[model samples]
Target: MNVSLLANSLVGSEIIKIGNEVNEMKRKGAQISNLTIGDFDPSIYPIPDELKEAIVTAYNEHQTNYPPADGVLALRETVSGVLKSRYALEYNANEILVSGGSRPLIYATYLALIDPGDKVVYPAPSWNNNHYCVLSSANGVAVETSVENNFMPTGDQLKPHLKGATLLALCSPLNPTGTMFSAEQLLEICDLVLAENKSRSADEKPLYIMYDQIYSLLTFGKEHVNPISLRPELRDYVIYIDGISKALAATGVRVGWAFGPEVIISKMKSLLGHIGAWAPKAEQVAVAKYFRDEAQVDTFLKEFKGAVQKSLDTLYNGFQEMKKEGFNVDAVVPMGAIYLTLKIDYIGKTTPAGDLLKNSADLNFYLIHEAQTALVPFSAFGNDESVAWFRASVGGCSLEDVYAMLPKIKTALSKLK
Candidate 1:
């Protein structure tokens, strides 16, 4: 069973492990309200009809061949226009590199920028930057953030770590917490990055930023901000990760793009090219045609985000109600994305079965079995196991499911001593 050290030491995804447990329970006839994975159940949230039809059309037109290593030029052009129209950021097609999904683009970013033992600074409770650092052989620094900042890292917390870092990974409408960085918050961090880079010699590797805004379009009412937009001078140092996976409920469609300095993007392109990670030609073609109609895209977002918000609101309000009822539970207001940050502070409590709820994971599994509900603990996202926070993704459940699960959770908690 000897394998490469990298393969042997690599840890599997904790979220996926929880999801697999949920799936196994479901297969055994358990009616589990699985909120572990950050994915949409197509039944509750289907892709836009226009986009789906375009995908079919592209396939019918025989766009089934492998796409160019970077991406379909038309799709890149459409992405360029999207940046201009949506975010007021400007990046031409050549500067954009599209891949199967944000994962490949993210991994490519790491491979292009990191060398073994190079430091990679990222906030704890982020999506997968820790694993990406491991895969890229970079020394990962997970800065612990406080709930006061909604689990998003502050400049002061990250400043001391940026001294010799090769990459600073950031995400807004951040995963796990569904929190976002305010303009002031992001601008502060951007200034820090600028200052750090300014102090570096040209011969030394500059600190690059990998900004993941995959949920940028999924915001509730808050504005999504980016480093480049706040500090235009930092444009060449940032690489953006975005796509239709979350925006269009098209995770399976596998079309994501990264745009930055042409030189860095070209390096990422070559890296991904060798890995054969291009988005399917048909899907790329379909996305290009569908995204060109801004009005149509806006119409879809208006309705889609409305549904996602309803689910998030239901869960938030339910937890707040429980808190008012003297439960040791709370929730952050839904800001963006399909997740609600929940505080189920029953870690030290004991279940009626006399088993001590030792940590967030234990409490989570208790709810899964007793409440028939599931969630991902912050520990899975790099926090200490004692942290009682968890992420409940609403994309897999309907508003009714969320409403129904609240009473079950209340009942389950009531049974805990």
Candidate 2:
């Protein structure tokens, strides 16, 4: 039986593969500290009490029905107000499109803006931009970023690719790296975008930006920056993706929003409507009430940040201590998000059984089986196979779990001949 070409050609998620491996080990009673998935263990980090209650109330009131394709008018208005208050972004309610989660909004952005063969530029070792490009049949242009810039691409690196690209996908408080764009760095990129769009005539497809700021509120000691916020002139060409998934520890709530040009937003609404991807009406109603209370939002963020920061700090400090002890490990400072950019650079070393470790994937499996810890290597995020860097997400583990895992990691590394 022949499937659609896209279905046949699609590679399975590397993250899921690693997750399944972890699950199998755990099922066999191997106490593995699984850190591959970028999701919170709700038991360790639950959604806010107020928001949860509101959700229950909405459901009890029989708010379960098909929501408007663009989201309920009140929810869109709440999102608009939240943006205006926090980041000074001032899109109207109609300019915003609500969906099940950030994934659908991102997919809709790709579908709405990109025609087949259109070029989509994004930094490698980021998120799933490559897969999105394949789904949309767009030309994926991967910009190689380096650790010197916190693994973020600069304007100079992106300049050559921007000439004919349709979308420049970017994210701040970036996933995998747990790093963010400094205001100055992002402003420079915004300036480049402004210039590129200015050069295009009315008839040409203008260069647009898909700024995914889902992890913006998770930054630690760093301010989140966006293109339009820095260069207001570039406002017309930027689409912003955000939601409560990270900030409020509400991933399963299935509420996300994207705001951009009215034309693009309208098209995305129609597309999502046909796909039946709107956020549940009860969840939408709950969020609308929850978002309007500024004091509660502040309180939730303060407590949530404290918990997340502790987990990140523990993993980051553990790896740093291993480095100081002359182990073959290193880690970047955890600036934002619930991930620590870690390096288990033991490639080419021999295991105790005389098997030579081959690549980052090999190291990843060694950590899973030997150390009883799991992590997603940077190579999984569109990097070359040789990059030994990996992302150790802290959201799924406890501080006590981190304390127990470090010794195991050290012992495992010592056994590598």
Candidate 3:
């Protein structure tokens, strides 16, 4: 049987590839309390009345024509203001490019810059899509740094893999574990990459850095971190990926923007101009309108932080109780994103097939079957060696429900000694 090499190299998502097998069990009269799927609570963030009005107005006004290739002028202008206010980044509208979601922005970045066989570096147990997107779309190798160090990666990790490298996709206040790099730590990385780029010489193109700030508004207690803040000289080499999904709970609208040097944005926009043709015209107008009124962004951010904090507290308490109950687990506390990693060891407990539970994937399946809870195994996130670590997303459920889900999770592994 003949198949594509890239397709062969790609790994499927254990979390979703399970294909509703558990969900089907859940449907057939089973009490399924879902702890999987990192969806925000539907109640806290409903579509705003203003956005509804905009959509209707667009429909009535027949604003249905294809938009400009880059994005609507107002949206790009608003994005410029957002970068200035939030990250202290001075971006012109030309540097702002919009896509359906940050996922495409990643691919667009890869398409805009990468040559075949370029080496790409990222921190591990990362967003699954980044790895695949680089490998499948760009045919680039992904250099993964271990998450054992509280998920803060260093330049040393990239040294061995920089031979033909072109892009470094970085996500802070990252997905899965929610860890953010300290300002100093981010500087350490950029300094090294830029130095390495110089040593390699003028013939070699610069190593592009794409910083994903999708969860920018969700940070609580800790200061917001960005590479542009520290390394001003690398402005041309940096790309910022941010969105209103988490900020406005508008994930359904799939709006995200990229901020970078005008040249890179110009290249990416040329590509997106053909396919995306301005990010959802109606949604762009609404965000643009809202940008004029800072009060909405401010109030929404406050509520967002509050809702996220309440959920984090509930999950923290859940882990604490489990610890008190003698469960062997580590709390990988996150600074921003809605989820955190829980490392569990189910060793010596034995498995149904007489094979000892060996890795995170096995434990994930067992929990979903026996515990009736869904977790994104570290295995899915590219950590296969370690056993019994999985993620719990708190924002998807309310505080009480989050507390309630913990006991259900504990139910499966309680018998372990």
Best by lDDT: 1
lDDT of each: 0.94, 0.91, 0.72
Root-mean-square deviation of candidate 1:
0.8
TM-score between candidate 1 and the true structure: 0.99
* Segments of candidate 1 deviating more than 4 angstroms: none
Clashes of 1: 0
Q: Which regions in candidate 3 have their CA more than 4 angstroms from the true location? A: 1-10, 129-148, 351-355, 385-387
- Candidate 3, 1-417: lDDT as tens digits: 388876676665666764376678867877655556666656755555565576677767777677677777888898888778867889889888887767777777887887765667676667764564645365444455555656667667766765556777788887777778888778888897778677787777888888988887788789878887898888878988887777777777777888898889899888877666356777777777775566777786787778777877677767777888888866776678787777777745666555566666667667777777666776666555564666777656666676666887787776444
Task: Count backbone clashes in candidate 2.
Answer: 0
lDDT of 1 by residue, 1-417 (tens): 589989987999888888888889999999999899899999989999999999999999999988999999999999999999999999999999999998999999999999999999999888888899889999999999988999999999999999989999999999989999999999999999999999999899999999999999999889999998899999989999999999999999999999999999999999999999989999999999999899999899999999999999989999999999999999988899989999999999998889999999899999999999999999888888999999999999998899999999999999998
**All candidates: CA RMSD in angstroms?**
0.8, 1.0, 2.5
In candidate 2, list every pair of residues with a backbone clash: none
Tens digits of per-residue lDDT for model 2 on 288-371? 999889889989889888988888898888889999999978888888888889888898998998888898888889989999
Query: Best to worst by lDDT, what's the order?
Result: 1, 2, 3
